[model samples]
Target chain A: MRRMAAIIGCGAVQVGKYPDRLESELALDAVRMALLDAGIEKGQAEGIFTTPDLRGGIGLQANLLCEYLRITPKSMAEMTCGAVAAGLTVKTAVNEIMLGQIDVAVCYGAERECSIEWFKHFGSALFEPVALQPYASYGIIWAYAMSARRYMHETGAKEEHFAMAAVRNRRNARHSPVAAFKAPIAIEDVLESRNLCSPIKLLDSSASLDGAAAVVVASAEFARRVCPKPVYIMGWGQYHDNSCIIPTDRCDKSISSFVATREAAAAAFRVAGINPEDVDVAEVYAPFSPHELIIPEDIGWFEKGEMVKAIETGETEIGGKIPVNTDGGLLSRGHPWAVTPFYQTINVVRQLRGEAGENQVPDARIGLVHCEGGMMNNVFVLILGSE
Target chain B: MSKVDFAWPASRHTPSGREFWAGLKKRKLLANKCQLCGEMFFPPRLCCPACLGDRLEWFELSGKGTLYSWTEVFFAGPEFKTPFLLGLVDLAEGVGRIASRIAGAEAGELKIGMPVRFTFVDAGEDFTIYCVTPDTG
Candidate 1:
């Protein structure tokens, strides 16, 4: 008797800074293809959610997109939570559909990070735009460096432990066409790369590239009639942790991510009436490799400090007991902030339907997707299944 | 002192940094406080999102505050030069504040938890802003 939500169609456009100034074109094109993929008419969607492109002006982006596409939604919202915003949008739309607010919903994101000129154009707004001009990029680097430093101090995890994750993810990326950095890397390579921030090198971070992704979500009855293969949203959770960036009286060892993920996992499992063991695949947002350790431990996949052992033993790989980030993850797949999480959900939807060709898990009936945003600002987890 | 030049957008809300500069004239920092939730909004908000509080109270904050966390930037912005320190200052009224360029220090002497006061500098082109050491420090 549980209501099901399904992603009927998905599309991605890789403009790749080719024309140097075609973000609007790329965004509009992605929207068209997504509607086509879902087999839904362009004008039928009732809700539209967008993740703001760093290149576009704040309020202008959403309305501009609506105008360009020539499709208007009864309700529209812009998601600013960076990478996880897309999946979160889907969750929001699904809730609204269940609540009888809308029928079909569209979520998408686009950016041109490869062009330095575009960044400088927008860099004028910041009062202090030197050294670390885009302050948000520093969040990932700092989070990793700080976490790695603390892990090293407490659990004896070396730089190599973190480096190995990059190697594995890059290896996974080799199989993916849209991945930003498919080229394999070594421990020495990571150590030698230019430091964006201390303890996090160039190789540890995802590339800032131009691309777009979109998905369509609808209610159970609508999905059953309109779509051939509908993946049920078995469980989902989102959490916000507003705390001091630097731990003052709070425990530094315990991050806001743990607090958020634990709550999300509990809610998701309750909704699905399942446990951790029931999950077959996991796609988590790890822009930095060190998070490969912290997230799994937080979700109880492994004991504290055991993620390194899990990675080293190949237990978290494609053929492992529980494959993770089979879609190359944000580190390899390129983190577009808003688009990345939907990519995670799309990967799950494909795997559940047995449509994932080379990287698919054979009998993955249940899949888990996790996205952490805004310096651990929010944690959103979704559990999907075929039944 | 040597001369410096900077570029900025002419915005009506605070056309060319005038919004922040004008507040310092009365020795007051203007912020939008959410009337419903009782939380102060920094950089001024059009509305309070938590409670859908449309009406915001524009109030002047007392310039007194305690230095939270800060870092000295060796590299500077176009409007700002090197040796500027950015700090998250907690006001006496229990709200967090973000400001740039702790002036009157030689970069090497910056410390966390140091007491500081706010100040303004007219860059002549637009408006240059900074925080300087307080008499209490």
Candidate 2:
């Protein structure tokens, strides 16, 4: 018989600049907090999973993390799928527990990207040298800006529409004490911000920070014995695009609507036996403001070209039809790459447990968390429920 | 503590990639076509990405395409000037797309599906690169 997995504990540190601490140190802090939250000892964890560090020379980050925590795990693996690695790590842990290989699994991620002088260097290294380097400067922002430009042409969505997303996420961040940027912003402020790339103002981009987040997953049998309230991991799904190179090899011609997100969402919803309308809250990983407007439509929450209307009509706001990014998302909470998705998952758990004091959705029972990385190449979706 | 300055080292290319870069110096735009599948690949590849067939042949392109998308990069690496237009151009043959700096047009005036043609430009240190400009014809 197949077993079920539940998230018994979640922990995260403040999302902001932490130049004084090492990445492993930050990860260890979150892991210790998660164990305390789960009411378990270090010996209870049977497996360890971690997202790989962007900084090179860290061989087998998961094992290194285990050593730092002083816990020898029977099975450990490092996830390196860029931003989606956090969600993918959780999914892998859940599967490992469901397959009866482990009773409890811990997944965590940490990053110190903001302290690096040339963070763009790490981003540009992912591109094909001979083909894409000569044309584009080979940075992450340029890719998103190109996609935003195309999205504008297709949907007739103005720059103000993207500014709305930035303003809203920043506004929501005011409720989150751990968010990187708590100051509420206006649409004019976003529009007047410095332009990093065309149509992608500096305020529209997510700020990378040094932080860590962790979660403990356990078998349903184990959770019932020790845990009081466990957020059930109803379903999870992951998908990758045709190629990591720009202008996907497939004939999809869509610059904004990523097929991988749609596939991942569809699989998650199918496994959960639920529809998009059944979701009480959602936390989407949108590093850019334009992505905040594009991803909901791609996930089938709204129709094509209708997301802007939904945004303008207050349908996606905190008190509207479906509250999204209640923890301010990556845009305001600070995107630490691999660790960002764990924040999303933890926020969903908070909402389900009615622990999100000010940002709580009324009686939220089921929530969704989605994350993607690498020019929309990889997408991971998770569905969590209270029951 | 003190601030440190660093330079990014040059990237090494594969044998197939070396031929593609060398063609740029001679103002020759080359693509690899799979003999078995008849699929064309830009930034020429040794084996077909689709069929993985090794029977590949080199072909010259018309240097013509339409602008699929573009962005004016205000912040970039040390090697590039700020506020330059970078574009993704879809080749006319529908084989693949090319990404490069777009010249001969202002950032505001560029539009999706605008016709563009390829050109070769000399970077410092004997390195040549491919650029795209608005096709007048």
lDDT for each residue of candidate 1 in B20-70, tens digit (9 for 90 to 100) = 446644556665678788866555445664575777776776666665544
Query: Which residue segments of model 1 deviate by more than 4 Å?
Result: A18-21, A56-60, A114-140, A244-253, B1-137
lDDT tens digits, residues A49-141, model 2?
A: 888777773657777777777888877888777788888888888878877799999999888864234456544444453243543674578
RMSD of each: 7.0, 3.9
Question: What value does the lDDT take at residue A160 in candidate 2?
Answer: 94
Clashing pairs in 2: A135-B99, A135-B100
- Candidate 1 lDDT over A273-372, as tens digits, reads 8888788888887777777777777766777788778878887888786788886787778766566776777777778888878887878989999987
Q: Give, for candidate 2 chain A, the lowest lDDT window spanning 10 residues.
A: A126-135
| Model 2 DockQ vs. reference | 0.42
TM-score per candidate: 0.70, 0.94
lDDT of 2 at A260: 84
